[model samples]
Target: MPKALLTIESLVKNYGGGAVLNGIDLTVYEGEVLVILGPSGCGKSTLLRCINALEPIQAGTISLNGEPIRRDSKDLPRLRQKVGMVFQSYELFPHLSVLDNITLSPRKAQRRPRQEAEAEALALLDRVGLKDRAGDYPRQLSGGQKQRVAIVRALIMHPEVLLFDEVTAALDPEMVREVLDVILDLARQGRTMLIVTHEMQFARAVADRVVLLDEGRIVEEAPPEEFFDHPKTERAQRFLNTLTFETVKKKAKNQ
Candidate 1:
């Protein structure tokens, strides 16, 4: 009840004859980390895209801090500045150095002075533990480092809400930890975040709420302990079972 930072009501997204997101509704409060978990192709990423207006919502409304982001609104550019997105692909410019990648948008999009934007970008890089890689290009950095740079780039916009679309999915097993560590740090700082992720451990450790999506619908949602321990829906139970079995089998092999 801290007054929702993000509100999605009756959200719908369709592609051709198939519905990618089916009448979804959810709210994210300030200073909370909300993890959206679901099987592949369940519209988790599409939902995030729709919220940020990267994908036009076929229907419903998405409001950030009480201002609605409708398809007809002329204020989308300003609205997008308040919502930052970090994708799984780490969509960095190969031609630019890490520092440039981080500062480019702020300098151009926000119309800030170059020096000011660079200073802010460096600070963000430092926060993400990438200060040493400032001059490195995307091709020179590891997957984890590139993703970190992407996060810093998004943060440079000073967004009010952050949307992460399975940021660790493409990272190597070892690299995933580094990215998750940074995300956990962000959560500790009370950043309002909505993440689509498969990492149940990260969700259990950092998320204030867990929303389970299945075939474009929210199947269940609750606190981590409640959702993981007592998943109510058949879809949630089956998903958890699959993950648990896979984890157990992997652990046994390792042992």
Candidate 2:
């Protein structure tokens, strides 16, 4: 059996006396793309945040590469450097140029020399097809370009695992494809990824496994074809039926 890169055991998170993640358990293998699909407010994003210690879990444990991400751990910074996150909003530093945004974390967290960091950042920018936009500021780029820069920024950190939180959610219809293409490319390269997305087709195309979450619990976990074609639970079936591939295909075609 392959060693799991990330493990969550009996995880729980609550806000205002209500549970967002209720006794959840999951494991992500190395070099696998695991896509979490669910309705809004089902705690998928919160689950991703908890994995990286961005959100405080109310109960249970999250371990990355066998090391638990405890709140008080002095090595949390080092842990974070190995876990890259790309958000929906493409949180670029407005004051920094694209190249600077990509290099900043490596320089500060890894203590890399400026020239070495810039070289790595530029290589990452090239990988994301944004090599020409190195000197551009965030305000000057389109939403897709900005998101690509965000991906490049995260990649420059040399993370062992990447977390994508509804990365295409904030994109326009046309822009969504560009971002998804980048993700698909990474998936092909065998990057370990945990993605929360509503793009079922993209999930079907690239995910090694699809996990359906409802009310903070996993309703179903299966390969994409099986999960879409033969959902094991009523909730899963309902969700799948609601997302007809024909409808989504037509919408994409029109866009």
Candidate 3:
């Protein structure tokens, strides 16, 4: 069997007297790109947040490379470095330049030398076609540009696993491909990732495995082709039926 990079067992998270993640068990293997498919409010984003320790879990356990995640412990900072997350919003600091925003975590959290970090940062920016924008502020860049910077910042951390939470949802239809291209590049490098997205076409193209989550539980899991073409569960079938492939194709054609 492949080595597992992330493991969750009966995970549960509650918020304001309601359960957001209701008994989720998932395993992500090394160098695997696992795409999460689900309807809105089905705990997809919550699952990513919980895995990154941004949110607290009320039950169950999460282990990364065999180490249990402890929200109350000092180890969380280290854990977060190994599991970077990209959100729908770019979340770059408004006042900081793009270069500064990308280097802050490495400088503050990892305490790497400024020269080494900048060298790496520039290379990352270059790869994403934003080297010239290193000195530009977040507001100065477009949504696609900002999201690409967020992705580079996460990559500069060299996380063992990366999590993307519906990253294309906020972008204009035209800009979606630019962000998705960045993700596709990462997958090409064999980076281990767990992505929560509604972009089924992209998911189908890049995912090694696809998981269908509904009502806070996993209803099905399969390879991308199997999940999309022959879902094993009724919930998954309904979810796929609602995806509107024609609309997805139309958006692509428009771009």
Candidate 4:
């Protein structure tokens, strides 16, 4: 069996008396690409936020390598570094260049030398096909380029796990492939990742496992092939049926 890297048990998150996450239990194994599939307002993004310690949980626990993660803990800053997150919004500093944005945390938080951090940032930029855009500000790049820079920023931290929350959702249809391709490459490299996305084809291609959520609870969990082709639960079946592939294809062709 693969070793469990991040574990969430009986996780409950409440906002103004209503539960956003209703007792979620999930275990992300080492080198696994786990894709979260659910309709909007199903708390998919909230779960990722809770794991990264960006939100407080009302009940249960989240652990990394057997160590519990608490929101109010003094070690939260350090613990958060172990779980890198890239949001839908690029979240890059507008005034900073791509290289600066990627190197900021490494130099300030990890205290790495300037020369070493820049070298690593440049190498990562090159890997994402953005080396030539290093000196450009976030606003100067296309949506896909900004997202790639955000991914590089997260990667420079060398996190044990990566959390991607609809990183391609805000991009143009033509640009979506670029961002998704970068994520697919990461999966090919055996990086442990938790991705929440609506791109069904990309999910099937990149995920080792697929998790279906409804009303903040896991409806089904299975390998990508099985989940996409042979979902056992009725909830899973309904969810899959709702995705109109023909319509999407027609729309794509029109674009």
Q: Please report how far candidate 4 places residue 144 from its true position, in Å.
A: 0.2
Error of 4 at 82 (Å): 0.9
Instruction: Show model 4 residue runs off by greater than 4 Å.
Output: 245-255
Q: Report the lDDT tens digits of candidate 2 across residue range 13-119.
A: 99889999999999999999999999999999999999889888889999998999877899999999889999999999999999889888989888999999998
Whole-model Cα lDDT of every candidate shown, in order: 0.92, 0.92, 0.93, 0.95
Tens-digit lDDT track of model 4 for 69-126: 9988888878888999999998999989999999999999999999999999999999
Whole-model lDDT, model 1: 0.92
Query: Which has the better TM-score: candidate 3, or candidate 4?
Result: 4
Q: Which candidate number would show the highest lDDT if scored against the true structure?
A: 4
- Candidate 3 segments whose C-alpha is farther than 4 A from its true place: 245-255
**Model 2: lDDT of residue 228:** 85
Per-residue lDDT of model 3, residues 15-53, tens digit only: 989888899999999999999989999999999999988
Clashes of 4: 0
Query: lDDT score of model 3?
Result: 0.93
Q: Candidate 4, after superposition: displacement of residue 37 in Å?
A: 0.4
